[model samples]
Target: MQCVRPLWGLTAAAVCILLLLLLHCHMLREGQLSAGACEVVTLDRDSQPRRTIARQTARCACRRGQIAGTTRAQPACVDVRIVRSRQWCDMSPCLDHEGCDLLQNSSGWTCTQPGGRVKTTTVS
Candidate 1:
């Protein structure tokens, strides 16, 4: 029938589109293609490991149901530096002071510039 010919054409087109979608999903799962996943990683330098930093999780998909390639986000990051707060206080007062033409007062130091006003800094 003439009507059957058009129906067959539409069915073939639908089948072809469905097959393409299935193949795409297969490729993604096999890692031949790329997909998005959240993970935490550390930073390293010259084969040496450093301190642990914040854990960042990134997603590639938007609300519209789309997938992004893995190469776009490989989590290439750097290490974090951890330092003690007390170590900073151990340094001398003169080392921390700057831009002072003179030093005065036993409890605090004065910062002054030529022909400028004087500022006092108390040691904490």
Candidate 2:
């Protein structure tokens, strides 16, 4: 009985930690949304683009009506209306032979050629 109680307590602690992490992320997201500038979260290929509070990278920032995006594997500020249109892949962003995969966040996408070459395009 004593061993079971300790195990249950450990499980509850783990759940609490997870919930705290989620809450922190949510707060961070809410705060960043109101910021006028864009922030670069990660430069890695295997991750999603997340907004941060810092203003260190000027290139990632967008204009008032625009949002952080990427063009041809480079950071760009795309118009908000265009982003919502959901027609990015139709614009042939990738090479003629490569396939374009739009990311869920609409922040950027990845282009993959038949030879397994992958290019990750990311926004702030």
- In the order shown, what is each candidate's alpha-carbon RMSD? 19.0, 16.8
Which parts of model 2 have CA positions greater than 4 angstroms off?
1-59, 90-97, 102-109, 118-124
TM-score of each: 0.30, 0.37
User: For model 2, how does the per-residue alpha-carbon lDDT over 4-76 read when each residue is reduced to its tens digit?
Assistant: 9999999999999999999998997775444344455555333346523222233354667876554444445
lDDT of each: 0.39, 0.64
Model 1 per-residue lDDT tens digits across residues 4-120: 999999999999999999998898776542333433334343332442322334333222232221122232111111012222112222223334322333343444545554444
Residue 80 shift from truth in candidate 2, angstroms: 1.2
Least lDDT summed over 10 consecutive residues: which range in candidate 1?
76-85
lDDT of 1 at 90: 21
